[model samples]
Target: MTIRCAVIGLGMGRGHAKAYSEHKDCQLVAVADIDAARRERAAKEWNCATYTTAEELLEKAKADVVSIATPNALHRPLTLAALASGAHVLCEKPIAMTAAEGREMVAAAKTAGRRLMINLSYRFSPQSQVLKNLVDGGALGKVYAGRTVWLRRRGIPGLGGWFTDKKLSGGGPLIDLGVHRLDLALWLMGHPKSTWVMAGAWNHLGSRIGASQGKSYSVEDLAMAMIRFEDGSMLEVEAGWAANIKEGELMETRLLGTEGGLVQKNVGEGYDFQAEVFQERNGTQLDLSPHGPFPECKSAYHHFVEAIRDGKPHTATGEDGVAVQELLDAIYLSAAEGRPVAMGATTTKTGAGTG
Candidate 1:
């Protein structure tokens, strides 16, 4: 059975539609957008029925699955609607503005007995997967620490659009870009129990670019967080749209483990990536980089379709998304409280002990 899918919210929704169309097990049946022009363009480009609202499409086409690419604030409502209408969902990252909202969405999915996949696109990147394999297979040894960063020089999307608006986008780079790296870090840590978070966020960059058309820049353009785990593991995550760096644009994540290390780095301005795992065996250091056909999106997109067919679980499942959201909430709470926000019990605690 072809999984009939609908793409809602034409911005990122178009990309979802394209991926779904190209998937062998899925069929793009309709497209919907609040903007009629975008909806019309999508309909013309993809040669599918288009509607001004998702409600109209679901009512008419009766979609089996939906990709909710609406803005941050609309994710919950749109996602709930899709699930309520007996459609599985592929929602964009952040899932919802807060952990409570994310939980509600999860409950909705359980109640409807449908699948909901949150698109943390970075987790699906080929380079990231290679690193994950090495790490998970004990090639990276005992991971002690890792650093994941996403920094851009002058890249700010939507200009005066919702991207910069705090109310709409939730919380700048932290909620937008930071969530990706944070998810990657948590995943690399083997989903270790997040003990607490200490975070610092700033609006310096966005505010400095003031008087521009960028929606008054109310959110933090930069966010740096330190996450601790119960397993004695730690991670440092940083994300920013603007910073005082001359490296043009830097997007990478490195894991330093006791047995070895794994690093995924971007090549200059290209989205093309490279990954490596380094280890010392018998006093000789070795570096391993896998090779083969690695079309990043093709793998992830098709994986979702195959999971639906084979009744298997996806790496980026709804459960994984909730874990990411909880970590994000802790990070933000830590920043707001100027202290570490605790989530779970730790294996070890730093305290005064009589030796």
Candidate 2:
């Protein structure tokens, strides 16, 4: 079956459109964005119909699958609307501002009998893919703990825009950058049930930078958290948008297990990443970083398209997104109250203390 795909929010949605257009099982049917320039650009570049709003696209565009790439706040409504329009949805990270909203989206997809996937792009990376295989293949036996970090130096996105606004973006790097690492860690750890979270958020840099730029900023610049899982495993997560970091950008994920340990980190503060597995044999520490080229990993977009075409389950589902969001909400809450928050804890729509 040829999956007709439409993408909303032209900024990162354009990446979705490109992937869909390139997939053999999918066709780019339409694109939507609030900005006229983005709409025009997408229409010209993808040679597809364009709409000023996602509502219009959902109403008129004949799409089998819709990619929701709008702001953090729009994910739930757009996803629900797309599902109601008989279209599967591939939404961006942090599925919604809160777990309650995330649940609604997941329920909507179930009722619509359509698939709902999240754009967890890192899962598709070659290094991450290899690490996940190792974990699944029992190389990393009894995984008990992990650490995930994504830190940036002076990398706050759009100070005055929705990104810096608490109402729109939910939170700062924790919800934006940290979500990716957190989800990656959880997935590699076999999606363990989270138990609780203790976290702290700081605005040491964002507030000052925003004031200097005459921009509105009411979110944290950095966040760190410790999460406990049901199986007695724990995860430490750290994310920062602007901070006094040595590297321009740093991303790392390390997993400790009974049999071995695995690590995936950026190379020399660059975008390129390398993965290594550690094992002890004959009382000797062995480092295994594959020497040859990695197998071509499938793109998350292509995976969504194939799932829709074949009526199969996608790797990153709405449930996975919800789990990630719940963790994020708990982290923010713990930061707000200076106390650990339990899993399945309820929070208001705007998410834990936006400030």
List residue ranges in candidate 2 displaced over 4 A: 345-355
lDDT of 1 by residue, 1-355 (tens): 8989888898877788988888777888999888978987887888888888888887887888888898899989888989989988888888888877877887788788887778878877666776677788898788989999988887777666798887888878778888888778777768777777889887776887855653578877788988887788889999888888876678788889899988787788567777888889899989888776754544555666667777776666666777777877777788878887878541212111111
| Model 2 Cα lDDT, one tens digit per residue, 1-355 | 7789999998999899999988887899999998999888888888999998899999999898899999999998899999999998899998988888998987888788888888889999877877887899999789999999999998988878999888998989999999999989988998887788999999989999999989988989999999998899999999999989788999999999999999999999888888899998899999998665778888999877776666666787788888888889889999999998888644222211100
Candidates' C-alpha lDDT: 0.79, 0.88
Candidate with the greatest lDDT versus the true structure: 2
List of clashing residue pairs for candidate 1? none
Q: How many backbone clashes does candidate 1 have?
A: 0
C-alpha lDDT of residue 130 in model 1: 64
* For model 2, the run of ten residues with the poorest summed lDDT: 346-355
